[model samples]
Target: MTLAKGPLFLLVLTALALTSCQSDDKPPQPRFTSDASGSQVGKASQREGQYFIEFRSRYALTYGHTYAVFGRLNKAGGMINPQVAGLAPASADAAPYVLGHFIPVPATTGATDGDLEEAYRSASWRILLTEAEYNKTVAFIRQLQAKSKLWQATVDNCNNFVGEIAGSMGYKTPSIWLRPQEFITKLREMNT
Candidate 1:
């Protein structure tokens, strides 16, 4: 080769060699982190006094009370007029049935971040799917669990485990396992 081209060719080869030798393995560290006050770091908390909302307002995602609100609505013949959420009785009648709700965020004011928070607040649950959306939520949770240090701590059930984790993000636990259908049924019973 030429005199100047020799050094350039060697540099390129060396870079390629180094890149090829790099490992794909991730370093060991906890997937979740916290702050000085024992609160989770990053955006792991949710704002209080707001309902979970998707683009169409048909899908609501919530953990404790907000989820209860949805249940209340559904049981009331598919609508709930909550005083806190500023929802009117008429609003529920017009909107489609809420679907695929999640309680990923904590119900704390100004708190941010919960893996499931935003999706709960802003997903399209009205579109029917062959599979249960909660199943997908559970799968996503498993992925999160894999990334966490508490791998040994099993999520024996979806609602229970999700509630426990949500507490870490700053939410109160509900007294039930709370699958979508059950939630709807519970709400209906309460209203009647």
Candidate 2:
């Protein structure tokens, strides 16, 4: 095999092994990480003008996706134009998503079309932020968006993306390699 193909071949083999292995021995039952039941999507304080940033996970075909939602709550405890952002391989084709497992692919660290939808949501951890704190965090996320330019399943995937944001905010983050469901749950447990 050519030198270049040698690395690619090994990567494919490794990705296959990783994909075949289960995240844990846990049951296949649907693990719901949020109990908000759609009335709300995450836990937050009741006071108005309380900003919140939620680290969230949602189901996908394979490992799933992790993202962040940040916004100010109205008097009724509803989010006002909640913003969503995450890192994912930039493509609509399955080839890139699958290829991304073995090598870094172009990434988009901004909104995905379905990020705000509740349909696939599996987990969330919300932190209430004061106005000043909210501004700081939002600015940091924007910086992340600008600097984050690649996604690889093993190295800097979605879980790792969210973990970076959480860790920056002084929250304890679990292993970035965990499946999204487990990662968010562990994040909540470690903090609360």
Candidate 3:
């Protein structure tokens, strides 16, 4: 027995329709968690005193146009003391700068008051994270550091490092083409 062309076409169309309907029933998964409990899988949150992830950018003349670029970018290492979200106290002598670097030398570094002052001078943007979320993010960065090889100027730079940290905090990773400035803008738009 042979099947007719019209009947075969109908059967194929029916199968496609059923598959599409099945996929539609499932809800889309969340990229990050905003729950205060911090129990949700793949979500990060803190209990109190906002946890901020900042992106600091520096500009340099590239080619002929002087575009806004990231020369030496930094992330505000977890919690800067005195319980301030974005502000770093100038008089706080013991304030340690917890920063991650792309260079092969341990993926992370610490700076004191003077270094922090210079680094914070660049245009910076902040996003709040919870204490639990902050701990998880720090762990993730440590793991990446241990496994990662030396940083490549073009391949694995500071922007890529920040992108990974952002991803851990449940933020969507921006396109590779986006510079630090553009990535921060996109992050602020999505977060706010």
User: In terms of TM-score, which candidate is strongest?
Assistant: 2
lDDT score for residue 76 of model 2: 77
Q: Candidate 2 on 48-133: residue-level lDDT in tens?
A: 87787878877777767889998877887677889988999999788988888777899998777667777777777767766777
By lDDT, the candidates rank as: 2, 3, 1
- Give a tens-digit lDDT track for model 3, residues 65-182: 0011111112423333421111111223222211111112222222213223433333344444566665676676666555554332233544565666667667666643344445
TM-score between candidate 3 and the true structure: 0.44
Instruction: Name the lDDT of candidate 2.
Output: 0.75
Model 3 misplaced stretches (Cα beyond 4 Å): 1-50, 60-115, 118-120
List candidate 1 stretches off by more than 4 Å.
1-144, 147-155, 181-192
Off by over 4 Å in 2: 1-21, 24-44
Ranking of predictions according to TM-score:
2, 3, 1
TM-score of 1: 0.19
Pairs with steric clashes in candidate 3: 45-130, 46-130, 46-131, 51-129
Which digits, one per residue and each the tens of the lDDT, describe model 1 over residues 64-179?
A: 21221111123222323421111111123212112111112112211122213433331112111113432343344444445433211012223343343334433344433343
Quick one: RMSD of model 3?
Answer: 18.0
lDDT of 1 at 67: 22
Give each model a TM-score. Answer: 0.19, 0.80, 0.44
